[model samples]
Target: MPGKTKRSGDLATALAALAGLSYLPPVAAAPLTFASPPAEIAKAVLDDEPGTVAVGIWRNQQGRFALQRNPVGSVGEVVEDDSAHAQPLFEIGSISKVFTGLLLAQAVERGDLSLDDTLGKLLEAKATLKPETAAITLRQLVTHSACLPREPQDFPGYGTPNPFSRHDRWKIYAGLSGMTLEHAPPCGAAYSNLGMGLVGQLLSDHYAKPWDVLVRENITGPLGMRDTMQYLGRQASRLATGYQHEALQGPWDFDALSGAGALRSTAPDLLLLARALMAGRAGPLGPAAERALTPLGYFRGDEIGYAILIRGPAGHRTYHHDGLTGGYRTLLAFAPDTQEAVAILASNSHASPVKVLTGITASRYPIAPATQMAPAPAALAEYGGVYQADKDTSFTFVAQDGKLYRRSTGTGFRALSPGGPDTFVDADAGARYVFSREAGEIVRVDYYLGDSGFGGFSSFSGVAGLRTKEAAPPVAVVSLDTQLDYAGHYRARRIIRTDLDLDVRAENGQLGVRAGNWFRRPVFPVAGKPDRFAYENGRSQLQFERDAAGHVAGVVLYENGVIRLRRLP
Candidate 1:
């Protein structure tokens, strides 16, 4: 269904965040300075993208700087806001979850709720609950480990602009009553909108009030976030028009799931929120800020401090969260130690303003899309091999017609544009990939999804997704008969089922372990370690023991301790 669209770069922008992205290496990781007027940085964010963009940066003594890049009359240009002041409303989608989480923390501070309280305890009067549902605690819900699914059961029109238009309070409670969890509580930090939505609902139910109203009274009201609310009302005109794939989109509404992603605000107002978060418990945010930001669980491989994703290390810890809805994108990140923060709001749904913000916050210059050029086929051909990662995943690249393409899990044949000699970027944006070589031979590829998690999806920025050539799957297979001395079954009773049974089949020094088991994988020969093989692409290695007769007898794996598996007939 294609039509003459008014939106900018609809197809390219739509794929920006969800597509295959790689990471770039700046000169070094440091604070970005603003030599050119902040406007230049804002333009950098808007460069190579569509629509209006605005950001607010704050420092301890520096106060706050607001910059806006207004769309150039729906044309192919972007202009700085001549208004001199940033005041435009945009939907802060999942970011609303942090506010919901804040409410829970506030309730905890006020003795209105306990983190350990179960779902059944709060919603028993409103809805029936299964055993697992009843066991869900407030902590699990806020941390996104409640084991709840992404959406409520029997959700109507789940993928439309108005995903929760029909999901009112009644339906939410009804869905909760019979809800089932795939696993027990604290399910290892998988993002769950339904779980956070339930937190808002359960909190509102306890107080017998609306969830958004609670947000106003407890958070926005106290913090003077006047422009932040679910409904724009009088400020409706100020609300920027949101878009998806170059077509205009209507406002998104949430009845019971308002806590999940149902709030709109301006860059200044969000900057206020980030500032409050930086102040910690002693500040206007009260103990709730500290409570919400306390390390709780894992989120996208890092730490999830309640609703916020906590990154960096001690003294440099940063709290951040991003929101994306119908046609708007929002992000808020602040570091208490550096007393610095960044807030971004964009009207274009296709492009990611957050990645730009990521660059701005990381360096003094604006991070732009790498200008890609056609690379020589000889250069591309060297990258046409398989790379294995630690988490049972692999990346296979193919060079065809002077272009390099990737064959990965979900995405099929995404082209990688040359950003540098050994670096490539996704044409759709939101990703960058870098290649490394040792001794003039390509060794590993390091990449990131996008600068932001929009995550709990494919791309989360910051963390490196490393793939080593040494961990690559078998390329030149040799017949099993060639390694007859090592070709046999091995069993480990000490380890988990993962390595309980091993069928070592190899050729050309590559050993395929767990032949008949589910996680069957090839182990490459480890350098300087004779009779030893590696798996997880070299993250782990094991030694093959031979009996006195020189016949392969067993395999010994070294982890935290030795795990010996006897050779089986």
Candidate 2:
């Protein structure tokens, strides 16, 4: 009853705040200035999206400037009214990883932990861990090189919109007990939530305190970030409603993985955090912040520093992190050389605040324009192949007409002009693809699409099986009747308080499936396997099982984990 009451209270508070905002004056744009023009940046970001709310802050030697704009509309509401300021609470998502990284630095500074300390050394007394995981070091976790999967394999309630709501400590430890590394530590940089969460958990165990408490005592409190916290707790009244597209969405909840993306803060608080990072001084944790910004290696189109990503060249480097949860999107970035920092927080998940944030940063410190280059035909041919980020997502590079082009499902081929050696740029989408070579052989490609959703880039390794045109096979179409047989509603085997359902539909003589809001796509029958379906360009597969009567009984969905769902009726 207490939990229910809290949920109701939170909703009431959020709705009440939204209602009160209706009567408030329209948020005015700050006056323009040459150093950091708020009006110009706001026009570029908010002009297209009329009802979006944005809070922007810039700090430099000239001074600090802040702006807030709440367009006239509530998410999913017909009425055109909403309000926000620089101090309202918002979920910072993965930016919380930076705070966790800072905690690791602090621990090392205090002689309580070492960057090279093994997972076995820290958690051996708490629970048994696999040798591979035990061998992973704290540095690897912070740098995202531990080769841990993005999420726990046995993560419960995987199909739910709030995937991490039910992922508590018990589930985390249980998931780790059966865990095995896909690759050894330092196996290139892969963004991982599990690795960062473990860092937070280790810190909690060492201090014998909760993650939030440790953060507040060591980081937020010292930085004067009074409005920042892990849980809204009694401050729910200040929390803003989150929106995905035009629909209202639930806020993310965290348990063991709170360290990954659980912290919530206001724009002012984040600006304070950014200032501390740029100034590289805030007392006890100041030195740790400096250490956290030190570059470890290159990853995802940027230098993989501790928990932060560093971009641009020397003297114009930008240290930053961006985050996305169920319904919130946030970005915090700063150029230390110019002492200019920007924090953009939005309630709308689809908002592209990063563009405006980067625009402002560029105004202060311009990035070099991308130039075109021409590589030898042999060099271009060697990079031609299919690269996959997951089962359902892949990019195929084709050499045609003496030029390199990229093609993918549902999209036409686009020219990939050379930007540099082993690097290509997509002029249309403003994306850059950099190839990684080992012994002069292409091994992986990193795609940088700019800071918009979650992280700005994804690393896709070249698929050896699809290296040649002849190696790939064609897909077979399923019979109409057979496709219809698989159409039904199914329920996830492991359900929490929230009911999880999967919908398998046959449309236009094709079979498609969706689980909650994760993704929806047509599943084609594999070349020779009639019962097996490939989705996301063969990045994932689904298998249908039959009953004694030869009727469809259940479905097995395979991606990062295997999920079994039974027919509802």
Task: Give the winner by TM-score.
Answer: 2
Per-prediction backbone clash count: 11, 4
Per-residue lDDT of 1-569 in model 2, one digit per residue for the tens?
00123223222222211211111111113312224444344443343332334444554443333344444352221211112233568888888998998888878877889999998888776668888878889999888888887667755432245666777776777777778787777766666778898889888988999999999999899878898998888999777777653446777888888898899887667777777777764534567877878887765446767788776555556777777665676777777777776666666654555554334333433323456557777767777777764432356676645667664443234556777767776533445667887787777776654321223322331121123232223432466798889999888756464555677876434476756533235566676675798774476788888999999999888877888879888
Error of 1 at 108 (Å): 1.3
RMSD of each: 18.0, 12.0
Residues 1-569 of candidate 1 have per-residue lDDT tens digits of: 01123222222222222211212211112223322234544555444334567766665445444445445334343344423254778888888988998888888889988989997788777778998888899988888778886567665432354766678888888887877777878775556677888888888888988998999998899989988999777889888887653447678888888888889987777778887887887889977888888887665434677687775444556677777776777778777876777777877664455554345334421224566676778877777776654232356666765767654432224456776668776534335566778788776675543323222122332334344543323232333454566788778764355546666754223345543212234554455566776654355677989889988899887755777889988
Q: What's the distance in Å from true for residue 8, model 1?
A: 18
Off by over 4 Å in 2: 1-36, 39-52, 62-86, 157-161, 281-284, 356-394, 398-569
Give stretches of model 1 more than 4 Å off: 1-37, 48-50, 63-86, 157-159, 360-569
TM, every model: 0.62, 0.65
